[model samples]
Target: MDVIKDFPIYVAKKIKHETVDDLIRQFKGLQANCYDLMINRVVIPRDKKLKEIEKDGNADWRFHEREVKFIVRTENGSSISVEFGLCKTIKSLKDYLYDVKKVSIDQRQMTFNGQELNDEMILNDCEIINDSVVCMNKKNGMSIDIDINNVIEKFDENTIVSDVIKFRKPSNAENYDLVIDGKIVPRNMTLQEANISQQSKLKFQERNITFRVRLCNGSRIRVDMPPSKSILNLKEHLNTVEKFPVCQQRISFNGKDLTDDLTLHDCGIKDDSDVYLLGRLYGG
Candidate 1:
């Protein structure tokens, strides 16, 4: 009987221990449910909202990022990638090159598809796209030194002969021939085309010839002009120097009317040749 009574006490202790264990497990499960509720109610929504914000921010960035990235290939076969806004000018690109490549702005010449790029041209206006390859050449690379009227000037080999002449003497470029090594280079050809190199010495040979112009009053005036000049140029010169109105002037050579577009050479005018100038009569 005593053993039976002790067995009941032992059973009560075991039952109490089992109740505590069940309560502990129930409390842990309640904690987990609360954690899930917190996450679903607040944390998950916040994370989704943050992701949406990040997505929108990226879209906005992409929308405003209007930049063009291109590659510049130098004469030495090296290349570099550059990026700029579409509105940026070519001058800005040159400035960047000067800073990075240590090249002066005047010496750096950029070209796209064989067309020389102007400094004032905008990047977008040049039709440059992303990943386009631009060519960068040093202007001094093929330049030749030229002496004009005792003043030495450097010009590129690709420079047109007429352009060099015009730079030296605007009013008389067409009348001058570029002489190198005792030979006359054609004015219509570039320095490179004329076989002129960096070591070449250039001189200007004036081809001016004196001619007589008979005015409407039958008075003769002596003029020195180049045969390459158009009659329009002559009329303009007369307008400036003699105060003759170009619009009212009419010229005839060899009894035939000379058009303004005809060059003196086209009319076969030579030294001491005489031409008649008459005033245009306008009727109301």
Candidate 2:
């Protein structure tokens, strides 16, 4: 027990406390016990035999932890299940995910309720005593087909989007920095900026859809926007088109106002890109 006490103090002297649980568990798994010595409350087995010298009266196990199943999922869509009686943060769960599912922290993101997982949640706050749904990361399961020859034929020079747009997804990246047909579009652009019309070549899986329409002026309208603008930015442009700023302009996509602050990507304007503009007919 003297050796164990010396080990935690020795290892803790140089290492971080977060990894101490794992270091103690890994090197001493099935060989010794762990304890709730600090603000943490898990009373490990071998800890009882070790000396309890109180540097401060606050050193004690606070929560009577109940063993709960932890399901760790990787960014690559792999998952592993285990049980722990100790309370931990999502970061620790992610470390456990990496250990069990071989997931890299960079490649993974955790989530709940279709939103990206927030690191601020806690077990006691979330109230998980047993097997519970912790979090999930959504995976982009769709892909497209690309034609390099068509790209070269469309433009005198090669464009990155013409070559790679098929392989990209809306949710797969924070934004897509694209140069399409010689136009530079920053990440987080909308379909309108690309001048993508309903009749334009829209390829989903193996299906392609095209749209052609008439504008309020009775003139032909084909979606052919500059490829470098985002839908929200485009909305701002549209506001100017009718002489109103986004905040002052009252409009909606099918009767829903896209938040004044939302980028078009934030409003689910991915495949169909069905953004119908609304507003007063007169007044800039």
Candidate 3:
């Protein structure tokens, strides 16, 4: 009787252990299956969207290094189009387009918002983004103002300027190779005489580099940026630079929150490109 009782206890323990092992195995299988399903679902759609956004001349999806195809409406009402790596600089774009259309580049001035276009501006890689940065339908008048106050405003106090100067093209204004105006200033000029302060949104210089920043509407402030800096860091720097109140405002790239510390390699920012930073969209 004692042996039989002990035998029953032993068998019960073994069965219990086997049951626990089976549960663990089932859990692992479920995790693996879930992982596989998620990857399948995400990767397929992502791949398709990427393909749709990508453009090529022959439906081949061959993206250019820095080329953008422009839908230019000629003066004759005919919309002519062409593609080239626009990043070769403003000068390069004018020269090449002149060559293609056989018009003296001198006759065709690049004026973004009326100010002659500068070669330092890099054309964004995406066709849609590049399409938006407009050029001259008219020559924007250029002038210099003398303000002893040494402060200017692109708009309201939400964005103030340290005697803010405007960005201009290479030939439009330069202190020589010394100051590009919006670019590297003569490493030697003190802020007082030049009065060129950090609060300025746009400035030009005759320098080499393909970076530009554009603010949307008038956000009580404007921030300057270097070309190579990532949009992620750029946004943080903008917040700090502009003194944005914590949680009062949110920032977005194109139309999305800057999720990661994404490099320009991932951010897709270009000169004068529209970066919509507004009150975050309201939704459930």
Candidate 4:
């Protein structure tokens, strides 16, 4: 007898073996007349995803990655039609558009099926797998001729300055700086939101291995930080160099919450890493 169970959409299937090939065959059959399965979950690389599935024998049976496709349209009449994992975010689609079409959208206003979408929203929410269309209404902006460390990048207005620093093409650097007209742009803000325009003279500040930090108070600071150092050490260093209060500083690395006692090595912080510092002031 086949080990049968209900699938995502109430369809029934069997999983005799937990291998990649086994899972593919099972999902393929479930789609039957359809071209392929649509998944909106964070589908890691095939090898990695499979490794993870196989590693844990008692894994939550419902936590398998699904394959999905999307059609993203912009108000300019341009559209992006591609397949991605359901675990991917709308921001991922925006990043893809920025990479291929050289255009970006303000996610704050981008919507699908008349409903607004959030950066954290997954493809599953759109219910678009095969031929669904996501409408993009014009709201904010895109990037052009923005120079970073001597290299030029065409960014969408909605692209985060820090994301650009952490994930620029060719090679990934640990840290970077976005400076416009002698003033540093906040990594968290979009280009258009930051008053960055096509004609603005933008510059990227980068060092070989050191990382930079942007405080909440519109100030920028650079540090010669190495991955071998502990987060505690860096906090102490900041307290001395920038007069920042170590105890009052809350630092996050790669979106991971940091403990004051953890080291860069423990937190996987590397050279050129981007560090975000939240400092607390004593009095107004």
Best by lDDT: 1
User: What are the clashing pairs of model 1?
Assistant: none
Tens-digit lDDT string for candidate 3 (1-284): 00122322333344332332232233334222111111112222212322222222222211113345665432222444657554346666666667786644454445332233455665532122344333422222223332222434232211112112222222222222323244543322223333444354333332222443334556434444554456556556666876554344455666667653565435665544555555445678
RMSD of each: 28.6, 16.0, 23.1, 13.9
The list of candidate 4 runs beyond 4 A from truth reads 1-20, 29-143, 169-174, 206-284
The TM-score leader among the candidates is: 4
lDDT of each prediction vs. the true structure?
A: 0.66, 0.41, 0.38, 0.59
State the local distance difference test value for candidate 4.
0.59
Q: On residues 129-213, what C-alpha lDDT tens digit does candidate 2 reach at each position?
A: 4544343343321122333323321211112232233234423332334444655543222233344333233332221122222
Cα-based TM-score, every candidate: 0.32, 0.25, 0.25, 0.35
Ranking by TM-score: 4, 1, 2, 3
lDDT of candidate 2 at residue 254, scale 0 to 100 = 49
Model 1 stretches astray by more than 4 angstroms: 1-198, 204-206, 281-284
Please provide, for model 4 over 1-284, each residue's C-alpha lDDT reduced to its tens digit, 9 standing for 90 to 100. 12223342232233454444455556555332222222333333332234344333322234354556666665544657777766567888778777877776544355543345777777766555666656565554543556666666666665555545644621333345767777878755656678877756677655335677777777768787655567788889888988877889888877766887786767866656778888544775
Let me know the TM-score candidate 4 reaches against the reference structure.
0.35
lDDT string, candidate 1, 1-284, tens digits: 00122322333344333332232233334222111111112222212222122222112111121467898776555678898766668898888888986755667777664356789987777777787767666665465776655677777665656657766765545567878778888865656778877656778887987999999877888889878889999898888877999998998999998999999988888899998888876789
